[model samples]
Target chain A: MYGNAYIDPNEVNKTHSVLADEDPKLLAEFEARIERGEKIEPKDWMPKEYRKQLIRMIEQHGHSEIIGALPEGTWITRAPGFKRKLALMAKVQDEVGHAQLLYSAAETLGKSREAMINDLITGKSKYSNVFNYPAFTWADACIIAWLIDAGAIINQVANAKGSYGPYCRALDRICTEESFHLKYGHDNVVTLATGTPVQRKMVQEALNRWWPPIMHFFGPSDKISSHTEILMKWKVKMATNDDMRQQFLNMYVPKIWDLGLTVPDANLKKNETTGKWEYTEPDWDEFKRVINGGGPCNAERLAVRRNAEERGRWVREALKAGQTAYVVPFA
Target chain B: MNVAAIKELLYKVADDQLVIGHRNSEWTGLGPILEEDIAFSSMAQDKLGHAQGCYQILHDLGEANPDQIAFSRKADQFHNCQFVELPNGEYDFSLMRHFLYDHADQIRFEMFANSSFEPLAKLAKKVKGEIKYHVFHGNTWINKLSTANEVSKIRMQTALNESWNYALGIFEAGNFEAELKNEGIFEGENALQNKWLEVVCPLLEKAGLTIPEKSSWEPVLGGRKGYHLAHLEALVAEMSEVFQIDPTATW
Candidate 1:
C-alpha cells in the first residue's frame, strides 16, 4: 500500500533540474508525466515547486485536523447520554490522531512537528476554513460529524492515490476512522430528526449555520486560482477544487434531503442533462476571509490552542527529561 | 431507607465521577503528544460515561432525570470528595490523581463485581474492563514521571498532599457504612482505605515522597448527601443549560 509506481529516471532528473533552475523544458516534462499518471516517491527527484506546493497543502491539512477538535470538544461534558459522550470523545480523539498521521507525513518532507506547530501558532500557516466556525450547541456536533467530516472524506478519497507515499498512507488511516465518524454523525442526526419537534429544529439550525462553511471547504474553484498550475503539475493535488466540491454536493445533498431536512441552499438541484449537481456558488470573499483567520470563532480557537500549549510545557519537559533508556511502544 | 439517605448516596457517587472525569478531560488536546492525548482523552470519556451511568441509576431510583441529577444539583448537595473536584493543576498532579483513583476504583469495582445488587454488579463488570486500561495509563505515567527530574517529583508530592485527605474521603462511610458492609453491598470503607494505603504508600516512598500521617479526620459529608462546593453549580449550569432550555424538547 505504501509503495509507489516507478517513474523514468531521466524524467526524474529533468524534473529536479527544472525545479532547481525553473527551466520551462523540465516543467513541460513533469506536467506530461503527471498527465500520464506516475506516482512520485520519496527517493525520486521532483521539481522544487512541486515539493513546496505539497508541503504547503499537506501542512495545512495537518493543522486543520488539530484545530478541528476544538469545536466538538466543548460539548463532551454535557452530552446527553453515556453512549453519546463516548462517541463524541472518540471522534475528537480521532481528529488528534489524524493530525499526528498527517504531521508524520509532512515530516517525511524534512519539516519538524515543532516548526509546523510554530507556524500554526504564529498565524503563518493555513488550515481548513470550516474549522473556524463556532459549534454553538450539541447539535452542532452532529453537523460537524455529518457535514464537515463528510466534506473532508470527499477531499481525502480524491487524494487517496496522491504521489507521496506517506501522505497516501496517512489518508488511508484517516479514511478508516472517518467512516466511523460519518456513521455516528448520521445516527445522531437521524435520532434528532425523528425526535421531538424541538430536536428537529436544533438539527436544522445547526445545518443552516454550517452549510456555507461546508460548501466552501473545497476552497475556491481552480478558475479563481493562483496555485493550480504548479500544484497540478507536481501531482500534489489530483483533482480541481470545483471537482471535489461537486463530488461532495452530489454525494451529500441527497442524503441530507432524504432525512426530510431542508438544505440551506435554495438553488441546489440535480441536472438531468449533465448528470451533475447545480447549486449557488459559495461566496469566495467569505472563504478567503475565514481562511485568513477572520471567521467568527477563529480568535477563540487559536487562544484556546495557545493556552493549552503553554500550560502543557512543563509536561513535555518532564517527559523529555524522563526519557532515559525508554522503550518505544509497539507501533 | 429515607429519601434523604438515597439522595445522599446517589449524589456522592455521581459527583465523584463527574469531577474526576472533568479534571481528566482537561488533558484533551494537550497531552505530551498526540497518541497520549487521544488515550488520555479516552480515559476521561470513560470516566464521564461511568458518571452518566451512575446518574441514570440514581435518576431511575428517584425524582430526577440524569441531566437534572447531574446538572441541577447544588454544589453543597454534591457528595463527591474534594480530591476529584480540584483543578488538574499540572500533568504531575493529574497523573497522581489518575494513579491514586484508578487503583482505588479497580479494587472497589472488584468488590462490586460480586455485589448482591445485580445491576451494580453488571455495571462494575463492564467498567472493570475500561478501568484496566485506565490503571495501565496511570502506571505508565507514574513510571515515567517518577524516574524523571526533581521537579516532577516535587510537583507530584505537592499534588498528593493537596489531594490526600480528599482521596481518603472517597471511602468515607457516612451513614451507609454499617448497612452496606452488613448487607455486603460492596466492600467496607475501612477495608478499602487500608488497601489503598497499602498500595499507594510504597509507591510514594519509592518515588521519593513521604506519606502524611493522619489519625481521625472529619469527612466532608455533603457530596453523598447532595451538598456540594461552589463549582458544582457552575458546572451543572453549563452542562444542563441546553437540556433545561426546553425540557420537553428532544436534544
Candidate 2:
C-alpha cells in the first residue's frame, strides 16, 4: 500500500535542487509504490516539486476548458435547426462543466478559484493553444467537436488513472461527459460528409485547418524531460508526450481515413511492424509561438474574457448586498 | 384546427425558444464563474432543444423542415416576443430574464404536463425535469444577488425593471389561446400568468426591488402572427447561412 512506503529526498539527484532533506527518500519510496501499481491519495506526503508540477499541469488544463468555450459559443445562434442548436448547446455546456470539475481539482492544491481566474485574466496562466484559433464557419463547430474535443478526451482518459485522488476523480467525470461531446462531433461529421458537395467541401476545409493544431496538442516530446521522472514516480502521468501523441495518431488517423478525408500531413501513415503511427512532426517553433501568446486569435479571445469579467463586476457586487425590493402582485 | 392557426401556435413556441436560447447561450464563455458558465450553457441548450421539438412537430404537420422553419423564415414570420430576443446586456439582465422566464415556464409546463396533445405533453414532461434545474439555478441567483452587495442589488433591480414589461408580454393572448384552452390543448394564459406573478412577486420583493409601473404597459403584437423586430433578420441570416447554402445537404 502507498501508506506503507517511505522516500528519502537526498537519494535522487534532480535537475532542480531539493531543500526538503526527506524529499529524496520520500520520492524513492513513492516511486517504488508506483512501480507496484499502488494509488496515491491526497493526504499522502509527497515532494513539494511533485505537487508543484501537478498543479501547473492540472491548472493549465482547467484554464483550457474555460477558454475552449469561446470558439463554439459563436455557433449557438447560427445552428441550422432546433435539434442542431440543442446539440451544440449541450456540447458547449459540457465544456463549461469540465472546466468547473478541473478547477475544483486544482483547488485541492490549495489554489483559490479566484486566484486562478486572475491568472487567466492577467495572462499569467496558459491554456491550450488550439483555442486561440477562430471558428470562422459553421463547419468549424463540427471540427471542434470531433478533433479538438477528441484530443482533450485522449488526455483526460489517461488522467483518469493519474496518481492524485481529486484529479483522477475529476477526470472520471470529465471523460464520461466528454463521450457525449465526441459523439455529437462524430454525428455532425458523418452528416456533413454525406451531405451535398458544399457541405463535404466545408467539412474537408475545417479538417484541414484543424489537423495541424490537433497534432500540436500533445506538446513537444523532447523539450519536457526534466519533470517526467518525478511525474512518473508519482504516477501523475502514465506515458511520455511522444507516446501519447503516437497513441492519438494511431487511433484517429484510421478514423479520418474512413471518412474519406485526408489529413494535412502528407507523410502520415501507420508502421505495421512497430505498431505505431509515423507522421511528420508539427512545427515545434509555431507551437512555441502560439503558447507564448502569439497565436492568431489570442488577443481577441483574451479581450473578450477580460471584458466579460470587468463588465459583470457590478452584478457580482449587487448580489453581495442581500436585499429584496420588488414584490409581485398576487393572483 | 386550421393549418394557419397551427402554424401560428407552433411559430410562437419555436421563436420564443429560439430567441431565449440564443440569449442564454451568449453566456457560454462569459459567465461570471466556471460552474455557472456550464449551468447557463445547459439551460440555453434546453431552450433550443425545446424550440426544436416545437419546430419538428410543426414540420411533421407539413409546415417546413425544422431548419427552414427556424432560419429561412422572414423576421416578420417569427413569433418570439421581444423579451426573449433582447441581447444579454449584463449578467443581471441575463439572470432576471432567467428568473422570470423560468418561473413562467414552470407554470406553463405544469399546465402542459396535462396537455390534451399527447406528444406535446410527453415532451413537456421530459423537458420539465431540466426546467426544474433552471428554476433552482435562477432562484439561487435571485437569492444570492438580492442579498449580495449594493452593486449587485442595484444591477438586479435595474435588470428586473427593464424586463418587467416583457415578462407581462410572455402571457400575451394569441388568437389560438381560446381554441387551445377550449380544446384542452393548453390551460388558460391568464391563470398561468396570474400564478407566475403571484409566485414571482414575493421573491422579487424579497430581493429588494419594486415591480415596474403597469399603467404604461401595452402588449406588443405579431410575434405570434409572424411579425418580429429587425433583429430577427440578422439572427436568422447567420443561423441559416450553412443550411441555406444547401437545404438538401445532410447537415
**lDDT (10s digit) by residue, model 2, range B1-251:** 44555566667877888888887887888977666677787888788788888888887788787777777766777878777877787788988998998898888888888988777788789878888999999998887887777667787788887888877878877777777887777776688889998999998888778877778666555565566666777777777876777776556
Off by over 4 Å in 1: A1-18, A22-47, A322-331, B1-11, B52-78, B213-221, B248-250
Number of backbone collisions per candidate: 13, 40
Per-residue CA lDDT of model 2 for A51-102, tens digit only, reads 7667767778877877888888888777776678788878777777777777
For model 2, the stretches where C-alpha displacement exceeds 4 angstroms are A1-15, A19-25, A223-227, A315-331, B1-6, B114-118
Candidate 2 chain A least-lDDT 10 residues? A1-10
Error of 2 at A318 (Å): 5.2
* Reference-based TM-score, model 2: 0.90
Candidate 1, lDDT over the whole model:
0.73
The candidate scoring highest on DockQ is 2
Per-candidate RMSD, Å: 5.1, 6.1
* Alpha-carbon TM-score of each model against the true structure: 0.87, 0.90
Number of the top candidate by lDDT? 2
DockQ of 2: 0.65
